[model samples]
Target: MMDPHDDVELSDLEDDAFIPSTSRAKSLKGKSPNRFLRWLPPRMRAFLENMSRIRLVIITVIVFILLLVFISYWNGRLKDVSIPKQSLALSKELARNLSNTAIPEYVLTYAPLVFLDSEDEFYPSDMAAHVSNAHPTMNFNPVKDAPEGLTLDNLNDLNDLGGDSIYLTSTTLLTNLPNYLHGQKPDKKTLQTENAVSCVIALANKEDGILDAFYIYFYTFNDGPRALGHQVGNHLGDWEHNMIRFKNGEPQAIWYSQHEYGAAFTYDAVNKIGKRPIGFSAKGSHANYAVSGAHDLHELDDEIPAHIVFDQTSQGPLWDPTLSAYYYTYSSTNNKFEPANDKTPVNYLYFEGQWGDQEYLDGVEGQEEFHGFHKWTSGPQGPIFKHLDRKDVCLPRDGGCIIKESL
Candidate 1:
């Protein structure tokens, strides 16, 4: 036995026996990196493998936060789409009619100025003249406000205590004021005056010739509402217009200006006398309303707008050309229309400058270079007088526009 054991070395004798080694078993049980984590750092890979649930929760939370931020930003830029029922119905009809109506159709072969001479074209002139004369008698002496003897003949002399100009012209205020005592507030007897600014002579093309496409212009001195203390955009002047589009001696569409944008309705949808459509201007903003409660899309204070309903019992100041002075020029040769006759109150068509002072801060978010109820940069431009097919005739900017496609 001793001889046989000696022939086999001590290491051979140990391998033949069954040996238990803890270190060797542990090394064989250790895990290797899977294909997904092969590129990661060794320590990071080990951490991720141990804390997979924690990492997944953190990623989900980060993604949710990013989604919330995106939603908030999206809603901040969204515009209001609330339109009244009658307005909506009229808008739909306009879309339907526009589909059948071909653009650039010359419908008016003759001048449409003849329509203005008839009673059907506008409201009664005597009534408008009565409204112009109806105002509260001067109560407060404005000598301190207007040191220049308060002639009040010019709009420039009507600055308030804060130096902000006002447009509330009364019979006693603007009529070469015998005294300087126009009050600040309006009473039950006081009636606001609406002025007829200008008119547009548009033509639409037809198979035979051209047709009547008249756009009548009206304006108010106080654009902002009395509420907000006239804080938003209490400018001195605001211009609102209504467009009557005609085809083959028949009224086709009526466009009303409401702030920066407006709506077009089929002629049948509107209340009209022959070819002229009725328009109601709100009290402060002087925005055109097709029907009662018909308001602008962006009006924050809807109630502030003149609740002027245009009907038999309730009527807005229908633009009476006889009571209000006007100036216009149209050249068929050049196909150009412009404000003319310097005798009119505002010879500003050629001014190409702002009407009011720029007193507000610059670079403000919405206040920058924008008209508001308080401060205004410039008076509105005259209505566009070119054919609808012309490149320059755009919506709201031209006071009216034609729909070439579905709105």
Candidate 2:
């Protein structure tokens, strides 16, 4: 009975002796101080503590991968847009107002017979019809003040209302290659019809009794070439031309518009049907070439290799433009356009705006680019800006026309 208190004191001292030292407890706390980790086994807690040292690096790598994925997604969705620069300035000689003139007999006599590619989806289109299907736009936005009922007859009015950035955007979005956009395919019956208007001729009188007759053809759409299974350089409203220079009513040289450049040939060198020369319109591009074959669109001269893009042409549909076309005489000296007949639509010739939709911007729906190449390019300038009053057989910027004797 006397030793009960002493037993209790001894038990208390023994418990105190078994307790961990303060330094050891501090070491354990440093390893895994988190309350959540304390509930885990010693081995697991140690493992988790060790992993914490490199956690920032692991998080950094994950973030970098996500950034890469983000960049790739936008790259595939967007495209680079190219807006064609304004056309070169007109010649110094200038004048005003419209007039009437006679269509020279030589113009019809030496007019070109165009050969459309059999595989081409688009064909020669009527200017008035195109106007009826489109509305005027500025910088890809609708021009609120533009005329509601725009047509070839009133197209020139746009020049008075800030025409610099104006564009005739299609009323319907160009998708799936619509039938109306394919345009009218000329036939013997349609060609014979007096009201039919599919092509146009602009005559310019040069020095020494030389006459330049430009046969301009229009197409509603221009399909681009496919590269690596992707389409590039597509656009709306194509305008191609073949110019025949005459010396005293005799055909002397012929120029075929191919892409940005053209070639001139002696009158006798080109293939002809009766008194008219034959021009093969390249597939989809509608570029006029003197011969029917694979034309390298990228090659500027014989010295260069044309291993990239090509325009294919063949003897397909034969179209005699002379049978149904509008005729006009462009006077460079006075910068005036004189229509051959009152029925000809001369107002459109004075229009300074683009004839088709402008280039679509990147990230726009249904438009994209691959490897720096755009799926769609800017619409080409109208014939009035194609150096219609050019003095040389080729455009002045072409560095003088190289008249080839053969293709």
The number of the candidate with the highest TM-score is 2
- Model 1, which residues run further than 4 Å from truth? 1-220, 226-230, 294-296, 299-314, 321-335, 338-348, 362-378, 384-407
Q: Which 10-residue window in model 1 sums to the lowest lDDT?
A: 110-119
Predicted candidate 2 versus true structure: per-residue lDDT over 261-350, tens digit per residue: 788899999877667788888888888888777677557545333566678787676676655567788898777788876666788888
How high is the lDDT of residue 3 in model 1?
A: 72
Candidate 1: tens digits of C-alpha lDDT, residues 23-122: 7657756565677887899998988887997888899999999998776545322122222354335434434543343322222211111111111212
Candidate 1 positional error at 252, Å: 1.1
Worst 10 residues of 2 by lDDT: 87-96
lDDT for 66 in candidate 1 is 93
Model 1: lDDT to the true structure:
0.38
Clashes of each: 24, 0
